[model samples]
Target: MDTQTQIIEQIAPYQPWLTLCGVLVLFLLLRATRRALRRRVDEIGYWLLGERGRLIWFWINAPGVMLHELSHAAVVLLFTPFGFRITSITLFRVQSTTARDRYGRVVRSGGRQSLQLGEVQYVRPQGKLISYVGDGLSGIAPLFGGTAMFAFLYWIATGYNLWDIPLDAHQNWQLLRPDWPWWTLIFAPYLILTVTSELWPSRQDWTGARWFMVGLCTCLLLALGLLWYTNHLARVLSLSTFMASRIDFALVVLVVLDLLFLIIAELTARGVRH
Candidate 1:
């Protein structure tokens, strides 16, 4: 066997687990980048505009906020047959409001009202089975939605379709320097910045689906364990690897965008301080 084949053979048994760990690391990196970027944005806004800087921050990230809410609304609509109903969608919040949980119970954080930049309200299903699946899917909609939007915007800005592109880091880096239309050069950065800023699901977004997610993961682990015991996991290794590759590609794109914007934010903040 060739060296590449030898390596694959050695690692084949662990590929799925390795891929999972790799994706998790990428997510952590994305999260760190987002927090740093947000902090920089906040600093710049406060330094230059005072309290009103919050408005500036919102406007700059308005596209992302809208996209995030829309993702929730879309998934909720998809689960309409399961009794999901979209009651209200708010793109921007100019006023404070009382917070409520997924079960409509009052939520108090240090006895203070909540501030929501954007929101999507949906009625939950009464059936436990459908509710679990619906809530889990709805909670993760932004991740799928943002990835799709980011890929689309990337294609528009650079004439490179992320789906079609190979996952070679050096070649992909070169593709980033595509000859751009003047308009794209001026506008793409802002659009990308806004979209990526809100790409990750918030704590509230994950709250409704946490238990469901845990159960789903547990089921998956049991299934995988059963397959391994039967020595049948190899039968599905190709499919798993295929799905893992696509997911890794999407995560890589998100992480790269997050890093680019984070660097821009950091540099901008430094300049502002000076």
Candidate 2:
């Protein structure tokens, strides 16, 4: 009868297959997306930061970079029992002079490496084994930290939380305007964009968390399979009431916005190159 009900009935039979196919497609697409996003970040960094040991470029993004590094350290501190000590946090690097390896080959003498950006070095007690989940979360803390930063800025600018941001873009314009401090309108978006762009953990960060993510993904697939077999998947995912929920809407909006921005950035960078 109803359009929603008709759609649900049509999809009910293929729920499990759809789930599997969706997962497979997403897996492939996500890898491509990440690569494109990273490439764009590199391009933008090069264009804005410039080639060479440019100290000014690093200084421009220093605040975001510092917060990004600190976030990694914060996770260890938050875990309580983990009791890891943060050894060092490098914000940016000075000009690195040319160096040689054993064969006296030239290395990355200058550029992004020279800027250093930021790093959080940490260490745990000897022989103290950290669980995979803990290791993974600690490495991914910058993602959480960046989200928190966005939320905080949203509150400061609009006197409300990010979740309060209306789904309608036209209605959300007021959130950009501050009643007192006008400069926040300019700075907030720029800071958020910088921090958000860096939210993706580096390859080294994933090295520690790779298996953990794999395990989680496996478990999730199992659960999804079970739900599909029981024919509850569609109902659970399509709950009409949940569709209108603010928090649910906020999470979806945030994810969509992130992906959309990344795709746009990638296209823009490619266009500039051409």
How far is each candidate from the true structure, as Cα RMSD in Å?
A: 4.3, 7.5
**lDDT per residue as tens, model 1, 142-257:** 88888788878877777767656543555544445445565664677678768877777888878967977899899999999999999999877767767776677767776777
- Model 2 TM-score, 2 decimals: 0.58
lDDT of 2 at 58: 49
Judge candidate 2 against the unseen true structure and give its global Cα lDDT, from 0 to 1.
0.63
What's the TM-score of each model vs. the native?
0.75, 0.58
**Model 2 ranges off by over 4 Å:** 1-57, 94-115, 125-129, 165-183, 239-274
Per-model tally of clashing residue pairs = 0, 0
Error of 1 at 46 (Å): 1.0
lDDT of each prediction vs. the true structure?
Answer: 0.78, 0.63
Candidate 2 residue 18 Cα shift, in angstroms, is 14
